[model samples]
Structures are given as C-alpha cells and as structure tokens.
Target: MPSTPSLNDLRQQQQLAFLAQKTELRIGHAHACPLPPEHLAELDEHASEVTAVLESGLTARVFQLKLAGADYALKKARPNCLVQNLDGQTSFLNELQRRAEIDALRQRHGGFSGIVPTLYGSLAQGIILSPWLSGGTLQDWDERKLIQLFASGAELCRHGLFEWDFCPGNLIDDGRQLWLFDFGYMYRFDPLTQFNSAGQGNDVPEHHLAERIETRAYFAWLLEQEQTRGQDSALAAFRLEKEIAIEAYRKLRLELGADGANGDVLGWLDGLGQQWRQALRGDGEALYWQEGWRSHRLDLDDDIRGQTCTPRTLARCDWMLNALQGNFDALRSSGALAHETIRPERGALLDHYRRLRSQAEDFQIA
Candidate 1:
C-alpha cells in the first residue's frame, strides 16, 4: 500500500498542481491593441520609466506604463502571494483563467462593455497588459453608476460568471462607463439552478449580486455618510439603492425566466423579488437596519482577517457601538446582534468595539 501524504507533502502537491495549471493558460492579445513587437521586446528597457506603481502588494505589482505614445497597465505576478493563504497564492492564476474565459465570451457574445480591454498577457511569465483606464474609482454611487454596475453584474451572471467582490478599489468609472478590471475573486456558478457561485443553488440565499454590493461596498459608504451628512442622509441613500436593486432584480428575473431558466432558479428569484417588493412598500426601513448591521460586521471581519483594515473599519465599529447604545433592543429584536456572547450593555459593547478599533488601527493596509 502507498504511504499517506503528510500535510506539507499535500501542500507541495497543491502548489505543483497550481503552477502546472497556470502554465497552461494561453496568451491572448486583442487585434486592435496598439502595442508593436518592438515595444513588447523592450519591456525591460523602459522599465525605469514606469509612470506609476498602482499596487506593490503580495499578490502582484501593477504599473502604469507609457510606451509607443500610449498608456497601458501592466500587472506582474509575485512568486509569493501577499495574502499568505491558498486563495491568495492562486489569485493571479485564477485571474488569468477568468480573463481567458471572459475574453473568449466577449468574442462570441455581444461583448462585455463594462470589462476593461486586455491587450496582451503571458500566464507563464505572470504578466498581463491592458489599456490604461483614464478614470477614477467611484466616489459616490449615483443612479447611472448603479445601473451600469447592476447591468454588468447581471450580464455576467446570465453567462454563468458570478463576481464576488465589489470593493471600491476593483472598480473604476470612466465617466461614461463603470469598468471591472479585476477577476481574482469572480467564480463560475450554474445560472440555471444556482443562486451564486458558492455551494448549491439554494444553499446560500444571502450571496446574491445586490447583497454583495450592499455588504461589500454600500454599507461602508453609508457609514461615511452617517458622519459627514447624518443618519437620515445615510438611510435615504440606502433606500434609493434598494429601489434600484429591486428594479434590477426584476429585470434579471424576467430575462432568466424567458431563457428557459430552471424552476429552482425561477422560484429563488421570485422569492427575492417578493421580499424586496414588500420591503419597498412598508418594511424598507427595517430591512435597511438589518442589512446595514449585517454588511458592516461581515465586511469588518473580512478586513480584520486579511489585515487590510481601513478608516472605514473603525467607522463601522463606531456605527455598531452607536447602534448598540441607542437601539440595542430594536437591533437585538431584529436579530442583528444575534451571535453576541457578551452582555448587551453599552459599556461592554463599547469596550469590545474599542478594542477591535485599536487592533485595526495597527493593521491598516497600504
């Protein structure tokens, strides 16, 4: 009988598998991209003239390169991922895989209008180049921006690609369009019978497109508004987004149903539509409070675990403490703080948040 592999041996085997798979990715270039052969050959010669270093973390080094009288974004993968985990280690390879699939899909389907155009890439060399996005990250979520985002997400979902991250950094609004340039966290899911790209179709109802944006992006934005504007301003913004989400979901459901969607998927969408419709009629405020708490806490835990804490993390903690102080009973009744072990008194909860905030201050991401 063969001996069982140790944990270290298994890890090594996984690493080898990852490397082999990454090596198999085919290099693809857009026909319209302007870079010539000489520019590709002289990447090293002009390396010192990098216009900007977008990111210098454990995953990859992103540089804004100006060559051939044109600007481009170059991403070079690092040998060791900064994330220090399995997913982190394989993120670059995962991105390459998604890019290849998406690029192919763009050729067959109408096209991914919201995705950044890739120029050239080599998976073996761990490098990808794309046209430089001449836009800034979204500062505020307006109606137009929300529509573009939701439409892009819905389009990807219809094609069986589920994006899991909507963080501020991964998205850019080029005035006329919102562009998604990262695919490290996007995964495949069955559109006909699944709710998202995780587990079974109905296993995780909370992981939908709207929920993802709410949990990962909007809640933090709301926290910031609660300070600069006020609680009423934040709540108003949440309500507006929810209204937009409701319409987006309705359209998605109609399209999926017409496309011979599975009964399970249809039923799931129906349930979501009904819930949002009812919430909009009367229970919207309650829903906002419940989802607001959930989004903040979930996002906070993610940042803390990844050691990428930001000012928003501290702001979220502050919001939590304030909610506990003024509306503890309502929050508790709504199951927002259902998992707490400590007493729900103001002092205890305040201490807890303060400790978390202090720890987060030490781990701010660069």
Candidate 2:
C-alpha cells in the first residue's frame, strides 16, 4: 500500500510550493503575501520585489498589490490543499464558488461595512486575486461603532450570505467602507426555504442573502437535540448568546429603513434574558440551561422575583420584545423584512440594558 503522507510531509511539500514562486513578496502586511501581477509576464519580470507578509488568515499566502492602476488581493494555495483528490479539488472548487458568490455582490453594491470581497479570478500559480479592502475589523471598533458593525453583520446574514464566520476579524473597515474578508468556512443558504425543502443542495447561499441568521429558538433546538450532545458547554453557551444577539440584530437592521420596530437591541435581548417564559411553553427541561445560564450571568446576589422593574428598564425590555415581534411579523407578513439601517433607541435602551443587568443578576439567583 502507498504510505499515507504525514502532516509534516504535507507541510514540507507546501513550503516547497511556496518557495517556488518567483515573486519577491512584500512583508508585514496581513500575512505572508505575494501580490499577483495583472499579467503573468509582469510577475515574471519583477520576481525580486520586496517581501510582504499579511497579518491575516488566507490558509495560504495572500498579498496586496497594485497593478495597472487597480488594487488586487492575491492568494495562493499551500501544499496540503493541493494533494491528490482529498483536500485538493474540493477546497479549490469551494473557494472558487465562494469567490464567485462574493463577486456577485458587486451588482448590489450595498453599503455594508463587511461588504463581500470582489474576486477577480484564479491562476495556474495556485493564486486567487480579489479586490483589496483595507479596513479595521469589529474587534478594532468601539461600542457605538459595534452597533453599526452588528447591523452590517446582520445585513450580510439577511442578504442570504451564510459566511458563518462573520465575526469582527473577517470584517474590515478601510475608513470609507467595511468589508468582509476570508470566506473559507462560509456557505450560502436560505434557512426557511432550505429547512422547508429538507436541505439537499450542493451550494449554500451567501450570507447577505439569508432571510434569518438565527434566533432564540435556534438555540433551544440545538441544546435539546442529541446530535450536539457532546458539544462543549462553552461553545453551546456562546451559540446561545450569539443567537440572542442575532435576533436583536435582525430587528435593529429593519429599523434602518423606517420600519415600525424601535430597533432596540436591548429589547430583543430581553427574550434571551428570560428563557423561563419560553421554556414554560413546552418540555421545560429539554433545552433550558438553567444552571450553566445562571452561572453565566453578571451577578448572583440580585433577585427580581415579583419586584416591579424601574420604569426606564421595563420600557426598554418591552421595546426589545416589541422589536423582535415586529421583525417576525414583518418577515412572515410580506415574505421579507425590508433592508434598512439599524437605528437604536438611546436613553430608554440604556435604561433597559441596565435593568437587564439587574434582572440578569436576578436571573442568576433564580
């Protein structure tokens, strides 16, 4: 039998492939990069350009280069992704398709911070060229900016782009616009349509095209399902938190376009704050993480049982609930929730957040 190549062997092979490239790469960018010249002949000529390394995650070397008055981002596959039929062909096709989907977004030109990358094409050198988007990610943004960041993130999810790794890292802001970068794990799909049809497609929809990313119920099902039984508690908890934030985020997005919803992120969070009301509806213990959840709260001493909330806090919670309800009603109403900016309510929303903190403390004691 042929000896199975070890991981070390694969790494060695990959290094060899990387070294074979003649272009002198520029260093200290995002990751190790060799910007593809627009013409292969040009790359052949200036094979001695300064070396550049990108502080990014291209799975392969990606470099930024300006050729013929236009900027382009280039990525080359490592040896591991180029073996025989295992990871080679499939990963290549996946990335090509992913790039194609991203390029398709050029037609919409939506004002999303994480706007999809513009994929130019791939080459024989195992390089893929995309439009360079220079920007900071969500991790680099502040709280106020985060709301817009979340809005843009939701914008992608709402648009049917299932770039599930749509976190701050993959998102960039080069001052003018925010752009979503690195799409290896992202796929496209229509959740309602896919779930309704039993999900048998070769290609997933882009993140910008999905009707909904996820919600509170999404977590409920996952936590209750046996398939995810062995999943780590931290991961599961994070997923739950993400779902809650996503739910509120979706509502905030619609508010950008003059929808009736208040776009109260905190209000949407209220549903997440109290799982009791939801768990009360069915087999209570099935999905409720009462213990893990209690431990996850802000404090343990505060108790909110039967205590009337301060007017501001109560109003905030009510607004959030209303925002969620409004979004659902809108989605089910006209077959889609219109895309718009997410304008949040300020003072009341702040009060609501504080109250949630208080209630969260109460939640811990429960």
Candidate 3:
C-alpha cells in the first residue's frame, strides 16, 4: 500500500507547485472592466490610497479602492499563509485556478450567474481585484437566498467543482442577487462518480449540500436564535432550510440525471432525496436535533483546529453542553456522539464540555 503523505510533505508539495506556476502569475487586469489607471498606479506605488483596508486576515489583506467613479476590492496575499497548513498556503493560487475555470464555464454554460466576476489577479504578485460587492453578508437566510445558494452550489458540483468553505464571510448578497466571491477552498471533484474532493470521494457521504450549509453557516444562525429568539424559532429556521434543500436537491437530481451521470452519483442523490422527504414528512424534530448536534460539533472542531475561535465558538460549545445535559440519551441514540468512546454520566460530560468551552474562550480571535 502507498503511504499517506505527511503534513510536512504535503506542505512542501504545495510550495513546489506554487513555485512552478509562479511564472504565469502576473496580474492580468480584466479586459472587460479594467481597473482605472490611477488606481493601478497607486497600488504600484503602495500609496496612502491603499490604506483603505477593508479586511486584514492571516492570508490576505482586502482594501476598498475608489476610482473612476466606481469601487473595487483589492486583495493582496501574504508571503506565508498564517493558516499554518498546506491548503491555506496554496489558497491564493487555488482561487486563481477556480476563477479561471468558473469564468470559462460562465461563458459556455450560462448557469453560473451567482459567482462574483474576478476583475484582475496576479498569482506571482499575490493580488486579486474584483468589483466591490455592494452588499452585506448574509444575515437572515430566507428561502430565496437558500435556494440561490444551493442552486449555485449544485451547478458547481455538476461541473466537477466542490466548494468546501461556505462560511458567512465568503458569501455576499446584493439586493437583487447572491454572490460567492471566495474560491480559495473550492476543489475539483467527479460529478459523475465521486462525492467531493476529499479522500477518494464516496467514502464520506455526510459532507453534502445540506451538511455543508448546516456545518458552516446555518448552525451559527441557529445558535444566534437559540440565544435570542429561543429553541422554537431555531427549529423553525432549520425546517425552512431543509425544505429549501429538498427542492434544490430535486432540481439537481433532474439536471444530473438528464446528463446521464454515474449510477453511484444518482444513487447518492436518491438516498438524500428519500431521507429528506422522509424527514420532512415524519420526524423533522428528530432530524433537526441530530443535525444540530453534528453541525455544532463539527463547526466547533473546525474553529478550534484553525485556532480562530470566536465568541460564536463558545456559544456552540455552550449549546453542546446544554444538549448533553438534557438530551444526551437522545443525542447518542441519534449517532451524533458516535465519536465518543466513553459514555460518561451527565456530570462528567458536562465538566468535559466546560473545560472545552474554557479552552475555546482563551483562543478567541480578537
């Protein structure tokens, strides 16, 4: 059997791949809607105009630049990815590759209207430019937004692209449209056969559309509701999302089926379709509880792994602890706690969670 690549080896491989592609990485300012010359010159000079930084993070710095009576977003990559991992270090290049693919598909397929158009990019110079999305991050995910997101995600899936990161910061909504601007973590997958871009694909069926939304975005929204609006409101929101998901999946199945996709892929879709149909009609409450525990646990682990814990991370921890306190039996029965080996008493589990929350509190990213 082939040995699995170590983390260091993977990082080295990414670095080498980036170096190989570096020569072709010069900024190709968009031909259709080019950046103003003045702004380009200012960026070249690294002037005070560049100081209007909209966001600063481990991997990139995003700035809002106004020129020629229009606003543009300038994202400059860091020398080393602060994410301290292979995927993080190569994300800039990955984004460029995805944008190129998406741009080509948008021209040929005419179904990818939801993606934000990249105006310019430079892999060598570590810069990208796009029209500043004149919108806010998704706050309340109504049916329209959910449908739009899932439809776009499904389109990408059909085209062999799988987007892993569906975090709120990566999504934007104008009054008329929803946009996914970040493609850093969007990787290729086999739409005809495989599940996603991870681990031989079909091995992990749980990482599907609804799971991604729930794991990355919806759970946080639900957490907010559990705190402010209460459990009933949170449950309602989950049901609404699931209903939208069912509709979206049905549409995707039709699209892929018409295209003569592989049987395994079709079977996966049919399974989810059946599961959601049954859940919607029969035990939505149980389904909600199971998915809630999963979303909270997975998302919490992700935050902790990235060492980017926020107040929200602690809130998820709180939810987990509370669930363990009152609904531990139900949670275990639902297989939400399958990873846990020792089925401790409520007191012991509660203490364990308290320790986790305390650890998370200390790791909160500013």
Candidate 4:
C-alpha cells in the first residue's frame, strides 16, 4: 500500500480539486472516501479478489470482481462526484437504486424484472457492485454481429427500462449476450426510473421532449435505411430483417401496456418503403418529399433545427446514429452496396448534430 493518509486530508485534497475545476473529481475512488487510509485499506483488502478490468472516459473504473460468491461488476467513482458536499446527492442516488431494486421486485408481480441494475453492494457513495450480466454490445462486432446485438437489444426493455437510452458507450457485450449497463441517464417517465442523479431527475414530456423526438427522428432515418438499403436479393433480406424488427418493436411496446402507436411510427417506415421503390426507378425526389413530410408530420422541428443539445436528447440521437452507421458499414462489407449508387442525403441530419454539440453542454458521457 502507499503512504497512509488521514481520511480528512484525503477529502480536503479532493475538495480543493473539485472547486478548482468547477466539476466533480473522477480519480481514485475508494481511497478518497471519507475514511482513514487504514480503514480504506481494510476495505480494499476485503474486496481484494477484484481485478481491474476497464476504465471509462469518465472517472469510474470497472472491475471484474466476485460478490456474493459470484462474478459481479464493481464501479468505483472518481473522487470528485463523491466528496463531502456531493455525498448527499451520491447517497441519494444509491438509495434510489436500492429502492429501484425493491420496486423492481414488487413489479415482478409476475416475472417482470425491472431495468434497475441488481445492486448487490455499495461502499459509501463511491463504489457499487451489480450482478454481472451475460451480455456484450452491438458496436463490438460486424454487421451480422451487430444485427444480433440489435435483435437482443430490442428485448432489453422487456427486462425493465421503458423510456431508456442505450448509447454505444453504455452498452456492454459480455460475450454470450448483450446487456444495458449505464443507468445514469435513466429516469422514470412513461416508463421507470431505477434511480436518478439527485439534481437531475427524470425527463417527462415537459422537461425533455427532445429525447423522444430524437428517438423518432432516428427511427425516421432507420426507416430511411430500411428503405434505401434494400433492392435485388438484399431487398428480401432487408425487408425480412425490418419486419422482424418491427414485430419485435410492436410486441415490445404492447408488453409495456402503452397504447399502440397509431401507425404514426410505422407510417415513416411505410413512406420510406415507397420512396425507396421510387428511388429504385431513379426518382430520388420521392425520398426528399417523404423526409420533408416527416419533419412536419412528426413535429420534429426542434431536432430538425438541431436544438436537441441536452444530455438525454443527444444520448438517444447517438444511439440511433450509431446503429445506422453500423448497419451501413455492414451493407458495404457484405458487398450489398457494390452496384448501388444510392446517395443518402443525411448531411442535414449530421449538420444538425454538429450544431447542437457545438454548444458544448451536451457532450456528457460521464
């Protein structure tokens, strides 16, 4: 072990770092806890079986560890987010998670397990351990692999999260299966919130319409892809996959008890289908018309104008964009786009994102 320091000193140093940066500190989680180093050392020794597995761009560190006699995920926060002043908020989050888990158990009125990560243990507001899932990520593989990822992902909501955000960064592919990992952005809206950051709670229809809009917009794009990526033999495969996905989506939604989408959701898919047919015959204007109708039809003027710079909004957008990009890349690799000269005019879409992110507040992955 390194030189032992008083817990008070550790916290004081962390406080200085946080105020200096005007943001939370994100390094050396456990040791920075408000406990004497000797005590902290004892805690480390207790969890000595844990192994450093990965580190995030944010301050949290991932560990492959054993808890409750089995493999689990241990995420130790960086010091800044768990210092003295922030401790209340941090503890509030932790307690909410405990509640989420219990509420999830109650919600299992039948066999429904809520989207809450299984909270197995916690050490102050710093480290958390959850049951390790048997899942990986969609972005971790090829087209076929990603398709597998998306297929499994569509079922994640069945586990719990309704108005969930599955960004590429938070998703984990644990080899055998794929799992939704991060809950920092989750909030119970028309769905459920396992826990929320004390300061930033949920995104209801009022505070954050951008998340759903961005979701719809991306579906608009995927509907666009399912339209453009098809033709010849690939057409058959594309339609089959889309139909499967649509069915999965429909089933998923129905399971949630929300009223069925009154074809508004499927309409974009249908329109994209028609425009794609026209594009096949070389009338590319069909797609533009369809897309223009969507901006008006979906009332996505905010996203169209790129005003969706909030964390939730951008997170959802990133999910949709990431999927489309991966699928497109796959089509090329499968020699699916070799003879096609289809020009997907997504520059406006891309430009909208650039405009939003340029504001600098929406860049939160932490």
Candidate 5:
C-alpha cells in the first residue's frame, strides 16, 4: 500500500513543474471575465492601457488598467517572490487553485457577499485579472466592518475553506461592505471532520477563524489603537470585536451541526461561543489579556518564520515584553501560557522574546 503525499510534497512537485514551465495554468469564469486568456497573457504588451503600477505586494505586482472604458486590476506574479519560503514560492499557484474553488462555490451557492469576485487567474501566464475595487484598505474598524468580516469568515468555514491570512493588506472596504481578495494563504479542509487546515485539523483547535483574524490582522491594529488612544480605548475596541465574533461563532455552530459535522468540531465552537459570552457578561479584562497574549505571540512567530517581519512585528514584541514585565501574574492566571509545553520562567521568557525581537529587527523586509 502507498501512503498519501504530504502537502509539502505536493507543493514541491507543483513548484518544480511550474518553474520548469511544464504546467499549463489557465482558469477563468466566462461570465465574469471580459477578456480572453490570450489577451490577459499579453497584458504587459498593452502598456498604454496601464493607469497605475502597484509593487508593494510580496508575491505579485498589480497594474491598474483601463480597457474599453472599464477598469481592472491585473496581478502579475513576481519572478522571485519576496517571502522566501516554500509557501511563498508556490503562493501564486495556490491562489489560482483557491480562486477556482471559490468561483465554483459562488456558482453553487449564489455568491459570497464579502468575498471579491474573481474574473480570471492563470499561473503560467503569471497574471490574474479582476474588476478594479475602488475601495481602499481598512484604516479604522467599526461594528459594521467587524460583523461583515466575521460573517464572511464563518461562511467560508462552513464551506470547508480556512483563510489563514486576514491582514490589512488583504482586506478592503468600499464604505458599504468588506472584501477579502487574497487567497494565497487560504487552504481547504473538511469542516465536517476538522477544526482547520493545520495538522490533522482538530489537533490545532486554537487556530480558528477568529484566532486567525485576531492574530493576523486585528491585534496589530489593536496595538496601534493601544499606543495612540490608550489601554482603555483598545479594550473597548476588542470588546466590540469579541461581541461580533461571539455571534458569528454561534451561527457557525448551528450551521455546521446541521451539516452533521463532527461532535468535537461542534463542541469546539460551542466552547468558544460560551467562553466569549461569559467574558462579555463580566468585565472581560482577563479574557482580553489572555487572548491578546496568544494573538501577539502567534503572529510574532508567524512573521519571524516567514522572514517577513515588519515594524508591526517589533511593536507586537514590545507588547508581549510589556505584558510580561507588568502583568506576568495576570498572564499565568488567565492560562495564557498553558499552551507552552514547558512552562517558561519570567526571566527566561523575557530573554527568549528579546532574542526573537532582535531576529525580527534583522529580518525586516523592505
């Protein structure tokens, strides 16, 4: 009997073939896309149509184009992705795959409200084209934005897709609705049998929709809120987010249960919902501290591992160090360090994180 190939194995095989130019990567929704594959492939030749060039993306460059009086965003994969890891190397291909799945999901389920519509994606051509979103990245988060973001996350979860990266760079708000446009880090899993796409799925229950949102996007923004406004203001914002998350998880629990999801999966959702409910009923200060610690820690680790550390990563490091110095007892009492296999003493933990902070500074991406 043969064993199943690991995700890394599959990714390596795909990357090799893709780099060797042996794989033909072409995908599109005919009803959604106005241009044909041949035209999309030759987009760079029509430089006169380009309105703007955005080179800030790590894995791709985006061109704002005007064709026949209509605007479009054409994303071209960078010859060398800046992320510098296996996942980064194959992200463009992964995105094309997820886009196809998302398009199929939309066809079957009508549409996903918060998700951006994909026009077409071709890995071999190194381009993806979609209608231009006039909206800008989210700067200030409000109840409407929080509700919509979580609702979209829950909807994706119910459909067996787990999006890992919800950073500000990937989110947009047009004053009406939030939109998720990046699928580079999104992965598929069995919602009926797993907690997420990590490990065996249920093994890493801590990494869920809400956790991913908080770790990747919310906490960094919250860190800014804390520094600019104050601790009280940051806490208030976090409370609002939690309130929205509680409702989202509650609905997700009911929906997944109806779909006959695993007992452990449903139980996990119920536990999170109940926990948030209890915290909201009280002051929620302890809950806030615990979750904040977890989110910052996880996000910091992610940035470091990906070698994509930014100034925000350093800010998160400072947050953890401050928490350790001033609120170590609170962290312990809240069970924030319970996830650590070997309990770290205060001094050791501080030194450990300080070294990580140094590494973050060294690896700061341009």
Candidate 6:
C-alpha cells in the first residue's frame, strides 16, 4: 500500500495550486487591510505609499507603508528566496498557512498575546500585511523578557505549532510585549504526541522549543556576552533561561497530560525538567557548556546547509573550534558528541570547523 501524504506534502500541493493561480488564497482581517486586493496586487506601482523598504529578508521584501493615517508592514514575497532550501522556497506560502491557523487559534482561545495579528494575506498576490510594530530587537534578556518569550513559546507548543526560527529579525519588543511576527519557519505537529515537527515528530527528540530558541537565537547573543562580560556572565544567563524553561515545560507537561497526551510525551517533558532542575541544584556550568556547544554546532550547520551564513555564523564556528581544541575532553565526557556518526579526533574536528568557517565567510548574506 502507498504511504499517506504528510501535512508538509499537502501544504506543498496547496502552495503549488496558489502559485499556479488555480486556487484563491486570502485570509486574516480583510477589513483591516490598508488597500484593496487590486491595489495590493500591484503594490509596487504605488511607491509613494512606501515609507521604508527592507530587502534584507531571505524570503520577502518588507515595506513600511503609510496610508490613510496609519502605518503597516507590507511583506511582499521575493521572486526567488535567498535561502537555498526547500523550506525557504515555500516559506511565503507556509507563512500564510500558519497565519490562517493562528487566526483560528486566536478565535478559539481568545488570543495569543505575544503573536502579531495579521491584517491581511494573499497567496496569489504574494503579500502579507500586519500592523507596523514600533520597537527594536532585543538587546538584553531580563527576567521579564525571558518569561514573556518562554510563555509565548509554551503557548505555541500547546497549540501544536512548532516555531523553528527565533532569530533576532523575527522578534519585536514594543515596550509592553514581545511580538513574534514571522511564521515562515514555523511548522505544525501534534503537541500531544511529538517533540517537534521534524521527521516522525518523536524521532527527533533533541529538537524542542527551548532547543530551537537556544540554537537559533539565544546562544548567538550569549556568545557576545561570553566575549564581552565573561564565562560567568554567559553561564548566569543560561541558568536563568533554563530556570524559566523548566517552569514553562513543567506547566506545559501538565497541560498536555490533562488534555490526554500520551505517556511518552509526558515522560519526555519530565526528563527535560528533571535534568535542568538537577543541573541548577548542582552548579550548571557543565550543563551550560554542553548545551552551548550543541546549540552553536547545530545552528552553524543550519546556516551552512541553508547557504545563508553571516558573520555571526563565522563567530559560532570559532567558538566550536575553540571548544574542540581546549575542552575536547569535557565535551566528550558531557556526551555532547555522542550524536555524531563518527567521533572525530581533535585534529580532524578542528580541520572540519576551519573549513566550515571559510565556507561561512564565503556565504555571508549581509
């Protein structure tokens, strides 16, 4: 018998249909749109309305638009996505689909406080619009910011939407709240049965909400903290984050269990919570080092794989090389390299990272 098509496969079909113009794709608050479908279809023709243009995004060109006494973000999908991966290619369509899901989730659960509200989206027009969030990206991670982020993440996880990317560009802090505006890398999964949206869901146990945040966003910032402040400062930050994550995961596990989640899922959450709690009680420096190593290694590999490396990627490569050279024994003892198919000797590992660092420099996107 033929295997059933996955949700990803179905979404791809929907994307193709929209691209082919065989199906109309429109969602979100149409009444809140700054312009009609016709105007949005040819938004470039009305350049006078554009206040600013941000072309740095990998999948879309964003325009800050002012019209009828209001400001809005108009995200127009690029003809070709800069990130050379299948996920990047379909990101625009995936974003639209996730937005629709999020809209429904909001209606059912009142609202997701930290997620940005989509004003309008049209797949055929290759555009998405949301209110212009007036705030800068995060420069510091205080207790409040960490709490808000983890709360938002837990909420998304409960609703079965696994957000893959939490990079700086996708987040905004509007004084009052941290807003997650990007959905391009977010995917669907069974919160009651899976770790994340990757593969068979439970198969990739290493990929979870905290891991995604740490790997994609937190560790990069922590690297700067380590360089400027000291190892102690970075370790302190990691401990704080893990404490918040522990509570968040505990609450999440109870919620999922109450909603009839299976034993396996509950057990996984319990394991994570217990591990962190133990580490916190007994000087979490080793745990911090291990997770930092894993996070940087995974994120560096992701950048190289997507061919979207930046200077930050080179920095992460340097961190990994330094770790391999200076702390190879500790890294091995911590079981951080246990996941590798073949454990590389220290020399081989250094050579491997040096090559990756060169590749990162070559593929700098900005």
Per-residue lDDT tens digits for candidate 5, residues 286-357, read 898889999999998888988999999999999999999999999989888877544556888898899999
TM-score of 4: 0.44
lDDT digits (tens) for residues 52-170 of candidate 4: 46654233556666544676666655554421243322432433343355445545653323232544334344555566665543342333433443444433334433333344545
lDDT of each: 0.76, 0.41, 0.78, 0.40, 0.86, 0.86
Q: Score residue 199 of candidate 4 by CA lDDT.
A: 24
Error (Å) of candidate 2 at residue 338 is 36
Best by lDDT: 6
TM-score of 2: 0.42
Q: How far is candidate 2 from the true structure (C-alpha RMSD, Å)?
A: 18.3
- Candidate 3 local distance difference test against the native: 0.78
Q: Which stretches of candidate 5 lie over 4 Å from their true place?
A: 1-21, 29-46
Once fitted onto the true fold, the runs of candidate 6 whose alpha carbons sit more than 4 angstroms away are 1-22
Descending-TM-score candidate ranking: 6, 5, 3, 1, 4, 2
Query: How accurate locally is residue 25 in candidate 6, as Cα lDDT from 0 to 100?
Result: 70
Higher-scoring candidate on TM-score, 3 or 4: 3
Q: What digit string (tens of lDDT, one per residue) describes model 2 on residues 1-366?
A: 986564334534554464467333321223323343344223422344313436344245565666555655656555454223323323443455566665556456645544555444453445565666665444333333434445655555444455434434456667655565666444454332331111242222211211222221122223334234544543444344444454544474444333332323234334343553454455443233332222212111111332322332233344334434444343223322222122233344345446565674443310
The alpha-carbon deviation from the true structure for residue 210 of candidate 1, after best TM-score superposition, in angstroms, is 0.8
lDDT of 2 at 138: 40
Better TM-score candidate (1, 4): 1
Q: Predict model 6's lDDT versus the native.
A: 0.86
